[model samples]
Target: MADLWTGMVWPVAITVVQILLIVVPLLVAVAYVTYAERKVIGFMQLRQGPMTVGPYGLLQPLADGLKLFVKETVVPSGANRFVFILAPCVTFILALIGWAVIPFGEGMVLADINVGVLYLFAISSLGVYGIIMAGWASNSRYAFLGALRSSAQMVSYEIAIGLIILSVLISAGSLNLSDIVRAQKTVWFFIPHFPMFMIFLASILAETNRHPFDLPEDEATLVTGYNVEYSSMAFALFFLGEYANMILMSGITSVLFLGGWLPPFDIFPFTLIPGPIWFILKICLVLFVFFWARATLPRYRYDQLMRLGWKVFLPASLLWVVLTAGFMVTFDLLPHH
Candidate 1:
């Protein structure tokens, strides 16, 4: 028993270290993503971004965090205090938990479950409940309306997103994200299934409730949306949760379409950079695109948005699924190509 315990100790210690390694960097990245968003949007609009807190505003997120921490929390007089407190916590946890199954490199994952993709879908679906709770708990009309709109929008878009994911899964023949990346070693899925890639990108933006699909928080119409009543650190949690989900979606894009951690080509004898570098680079690029879209595009009308998701993307994704399935069957029928 003593020997067995000794053997297990190192493994447990290593696992803890690994978890820290992923979690710490993820927290830091979430902070910096906000900084990057401001800088990117500022540059796009020809305006100066934050520059005072730190050199070129590098430490601005820290300063902003400190400000939020110092501020007082206020619960609406007629609101359910407990649920108001719990809403942001739930969103933050769900946002962070989705990263557990995402592989950053070869055999580099916190938990590489076989049903990793399904796990992500389920976890993301639960995020809406947090928003709904926040809206209801706040006891405000704007928050309530935002929550209702967000729940409906997320539910509709989620179906299209699931169909798009199904198309990719059909092509890869595995729900494991790492396995999907491996299947794309010869050729990335984006190259062949461009339509699915387009739909996936749109769905992710909708999933994150970013601009054009940002009806829930439309300042002109819905004040500050579900988080309107939240202040101080409580508000910060929801902000962090949104950015974290953005990064998570970007990471998923890397794994599913960009070949998770496989370099452009495994040609060199000794590669200087680690796999995480490529993963980060890809994520940053995707994030930049998100900001770019925000800067360039106008918000879609609610009716048009629903029509595009239901009529356009859903039908397109369904066709792609059938098409991919047929291609797979034909390939299997033919000699190894």
Candidate 2:
């Protein structure tokens, strides 16, 4: 019994450590991403952002978090009492759950299931439920409208995103994220599938409800959208959830197209720097791209956004899928070594 328990103890300890690895960094990044966003946008618009909080506004997020921590929790008079409290929790959980299967580095995944990609897609899809519930439970037209728009937009782009992922999965012949990264050891998929990468990036922006695609939360129209009624820690949960999803999406992009945690090349003498560094670098780059897009692009008109997703990205991804299939068959790139 002692021997058996000893063998199991290390596995359980390792699992606890793995869970901490996922949760801790994510929480810290969520705080800092808000800071980074303010700084980046401030610089872009020729204004100072969070100058008073610590040197160069490094502690602005911390100050903001402290403020939210003490804010009052106000439940609206007519809302569904249960779901009104639960909606943000649901959104926050779904956001973090997707990270469970994401391989941060070589042999550093929390729960590397065989269907990791599928699990991500499914969990992401469930995020809409949280938005929908928040809107419906809020008993506000603006909130309802925002929820509806966000759901529709997310669903529309998700189809194209699914197709884009399908193309890569076909090329790599596996749904496991680690397998996908390993498949890119010789050459990343972005080279042959540049169009797919473009489509995927656009769809991700839409899915995450980021700027230019942030129609649901359009301040001019929806007045802060679904979480309009939320206050205090409830509001903070939604905020943290959004940033968590952003980081998770960036991690996915890194694993899929940026070689997961693999360094640029193995030629460097300092090969001992754990794979997590490369993963972090790639995620930062993707996040910067998100910030850059927000800084540069104007929001799309509703009709134009819908048309682009349905009429443009959908067809483009579909075409790429077929083209990739034909190329693979013709050139015999399938059965990838």
Candidate 3:
């Protein structure tokens, strides 16, 4: 019995440690991603951001987190208490768990599943449920409407995103993320599939409910959207989940299009840096574009957003998938699994 207990407990403990190694730093990164977003936007707008917190505002995220920690969690009088509370937790957990298959460097991933892209797709699709639950539990028409909008938007864009991933998978000849990255050794997928890459970037922006497509939380109409009744840490969880999803999507983009941890070139300077560092730098570059879009782009009209998803991205991505398969077959360019 002791031997059996030790065997089970030891592996469980090690697994817990591995999860912590990924999650703790990811949470910290999520906090600072907010800080970086603010500072980046501040620069784009020619203003200082978070200068007073601690040494160029390095401590601002900590301060913001502490403030949220102490605030009163105001549950709506009519809210379904359990689901209302569970919603943000759902959102945050989904955001974190998607990182399990995201390889930071060669052979550095948690689950390393065969269908890693499918896992990420399913995780992202489930994210909308949290918003829907928040909207329903809040008992607010505005929140419900926001939830409806988000569900429609996310569903529409996910189709296009999935098709785009199919195109990448066709080129890479594997659904395993590490295999996808290794396939890009000859050239990043983005160069060959530039149009698909641009569409993917836009799709992820909508997928994360970020700028130009932030209709779910549109201040003009929805007044704060789905979590309108949430406060304190509940709200913070939703906030953290958004930034985390942004990073996750960027990581997926890095894996699919930019080559997960590959240096741009095999030259001396690029190769000297480690693979994980290259992966991180790629994520940061993608994140900067997220911030830049927020600073520069106008919010799309709801109709325009829907049209782009259905009429533009979906058809384009579907056509690309077909073209990619045909091209690979015609030219014998398919990577051997």
Candidate 4:
């Protein structure tokens, strides 16, 4: 019994505790981010947002979640029940598993893997699986079409994203995210690599299926698209996965460009606050852009989205990578990993 407790139970228990520490706060943040989106977009659209849910609609997410929890989960008679049920689970899980490598602050990551950037990219790329599964399982034309559109879009943007990340990796000279953040101590990557920064931002929007680039589930045509057959908790999981992915993408952007957890100038007012606070603020800034784009821009047609990814972003990012490397090599500015 003593041996079992020491060798097995305790480690498992401790791991669970540590996981809860990250997960609970994360779930809470996810809930409130939904609220923030509604509030921000509503303000942008000149309307009151969720005023009746709680104190200024503060409790709306909780209420909505509960409603979703109780609603009936309907599986189409023609659908593959197994894969239909598994799709959202896959989405929710993959969206979360990537967080393992994310460094929230100095020494604040769950797993400080050397190839953290690669891990994140791989997980993000795999997110297409959930969509494809959902589409095929649903046995609905609209869902299948939406899924195919999303898969193609994600793949296209990912290529540009890969090149942009390669540029950052070349500059940082390491695959570890913490090292990447610390590499920005002298000057944030965005300052020097502003063009790549912009490209990265645009790529992530398409990758995460954000507005203007969200052709997969274009409400006008697809009627909710790939998840059209989902309802109740099934739909809720997809919703959760999307918002979670948004936050994760924002975090990745901050880590890559905004100097994750680093004070702006290490000066009096800037360094006065804790690192995690700066990280959170940067995330909020990025997320606000997500909502802002939704409110301000119109949805793109699938062809336009494809053209932007392949013709515009792909070439631009590729060119910048070569230029960045050449410039660094010529100047002897490339840092050693």
Indicate which candidate wins on lDDT: 3
Query: Candidate 2 has which clashing residue pairs, if any?
Result: none
lDDT of 1 by residue, 272-324 (tens): 67877888888888898789888889998888888988899889888888888
Per-residue lDDT tens digits of candidate 3, residues 248-332? Answer: 9999999999998999998999999999999999999999989999999999999999999999999999999999999999999
TM-score of each: 0.95, 0.95, 0.98, 0.98
Native-vs-model 2 lDDT?
A: 0.90
Residue-level lDDT of model 4, residues 1-337, one tens digit each, is 8897689888788878878888888889999999999999999999988899879999999999999999999999999999999999999999898889888899998889999999998999899999999999999999999999999999999999999999999899999999999999989999988999988888889999999798899889999899999999999999999999999999999999999999889889988898999999999999998999899998887888899999999999999999999999999988853
Model 2 segments beyond 4 Å from truth?
1-13, 269-273
lDDT of 2 by residue, 1-337 (tens): 9999999998999888888878997899999998898888889999987889789889888898999999999999999989999999999999988988999777788887889999999999999999999999999999999999999999999999889888998889899999999989888888778888877888889999998899999999999899899999999999999889999999998888888888777776536777899899999999998898899999998889999999999999999899888988998888754
Superposed on all Cα atoms, the candidates' RMSDs to the truth, in angstroms, are: 2.2, 1.8, 1.0, 1.2
Which whole-number lDDT from 0 to 100 does residue 302 have in model 2? 86
C-alpha root-mean-square deviation, candidate 4: 1.2
Ranking by TM-score: 3, 4, 2, 1
Quote the lDDT for 247 in model 3: 93
TM-score of model number 2:
0.95
Rate residue 105 of model 1 by lDDT: 86
lDDT of 3 at 156: 96
Which residue pairs collide in model 3, if any?
A: none
Better of 2 and 4 by lDDT: 4
Once model 4 is optimally superposed onto the true structure by TM-score, how far is the C-alpha of residue 161 displaced, in angstroms? 0.7
